[model samples]
Target: MPTISMTVNGKSVSGEAEGRTLLVSFLREELGLTGTHVGCDTSQCGACIVHVDGQSVKACTMFAAEAEGAQVTTIEGMANPDGSLGVIQQAFQDNHGLQCGFCTPGMVMTAADLLKNNPNPSEKEVREYLEGNLCRCTGYHNIVKSILAAAATMRGEQVAAE
Candidate 1:
């Protein structure tokens, strides 16, 4: 087992992991962050997405040891310190972007990163950028709308104050 050290959900953590242990497993099993779900074992699904060094990465495709010295942010870390939902998460909830909630965490995290990179994304741009994330619920229309709405809110544009 290789000992890996990294910051997860704003807390520094060190642990021993098998060479083949994926980061998603490390988060869900060892760190008790079950919010990051594994919808598919293959990396094609973005359900296991998380922030690594400020970039969204598929945790299922990365080994825990490979994340040593990096910073990881799971869905559980997206909320405010007081446990209030983050703006992106709020947007998802307000817009009904989630149905089963299995993909919401990853979608919210990816949308947060997307908005951070480009605050005002067009509908086409949002669809294009979110191609990697698959949502079997809500038909993705609401998800796109939620992301755009969140983007507007983040940019201080008037979004009717929902």
Candidate 2:
């Protein structure tokens, strides 16, 4: 076993990981940050999405040892310092973006990445950006709306009432 160290959610942390230990496992089992769900062991689902070095990466596809010295941000980190939901999260709740909520964390993380790159994404663009994430719940109408609203909020623009 190797001791892997990384900056997780703006905090420094280290844990033991086997060479085969997935980053998702390390995050959930070792770090106890279970917000990053393990929907599929394969990379087909984006439920284990997390930000590594400021880029969204599928935690299940990466080894914990590979995240050494990296800066990782899990869904648990996507909140205000006071524990309130972050902008994207709040938008999700406000727009009813979730149903079973199984995919909400991944959707939110992907939206964050998309917004960071394209602060104002079109409806089609949001749909395209979310291709990797899947939700067996709603038709994604409200999910798209939530991302758009979050984008507007992040841009300091007023979110028009639906």
Candidate 3:
């Protein structure tokens, strides 16, 4: 095993990893950040999505060693400093964006990335952005609504109008 260090969730963390270790395993197994799920062993499912140096990447696709000295933000890090749910998360809850909860982390991570790039995405754009994430539950209606609502709220507009 080799030592790897990275800044995760605003904290400095170090761990041991084999050359073949994936970032997802390091986060969940070594660092105990289980919020980053492994819904699909393949990278097709975005359940293991995380922000790597401020850009979203599927953790299963990246080796742990590749993340050396990088900044990683998991779902656990998406909260306010005081530990309350962040605006996007709150929007998901308010709009009923989750059922079974298996896909919420991925959906939320993708939504965060989309909102980061486009503050006010159209409904079509929202639907398109979510194409990579498969939610067996909710049929994606409320997830789309939640993303739109979160975008409106992030833009300081009244969420009710959206």
- Per-residue error for 5 in candidate 3, Å, reads 0.5
lDDT of 2: 0.95
Clashing pairs for model 1 are none
- lDDT per residue for candidate 3 within 1-162, as digits (tens), equals 789999998999999999999999999999999999998878887889999998888999999999999999999999999999999899999999998888898889999999999998999999998888888889999999999999988999986633
Name the top TM-score candidate. 2
Q: How do the candidates rank by TM-score, highest first?
A: 2, 3, 1
Query: Residue 14 deviation, candidate 1, in Å?
Result: 1.4
Compared with the true structure, the alpha-carbon lDDT of candidate 1 equals: 0.90
TM-score of each: 0.96, 0.98, 0.96
Q: Which order, best to worst by lDDT?
A: 2, 3, 1
The residue-level lDDT of candidate 1 at 29 comes to 89
| CA shift of 59, model 1, Å | 0.4
**Number of clashes recorded per candidate:** 0, 0, 0
Winner on lDDT (1 vs 2): 2
| Model 1: residues with Cα > 4 Å off, grouped in runs | none
Candidate 1 per-residue lDDT over residues 38-150, each given as its tens digit: 98879876999999999999999999999999999999999989999988898888898999999888898889888888888899989987878888878999999899998
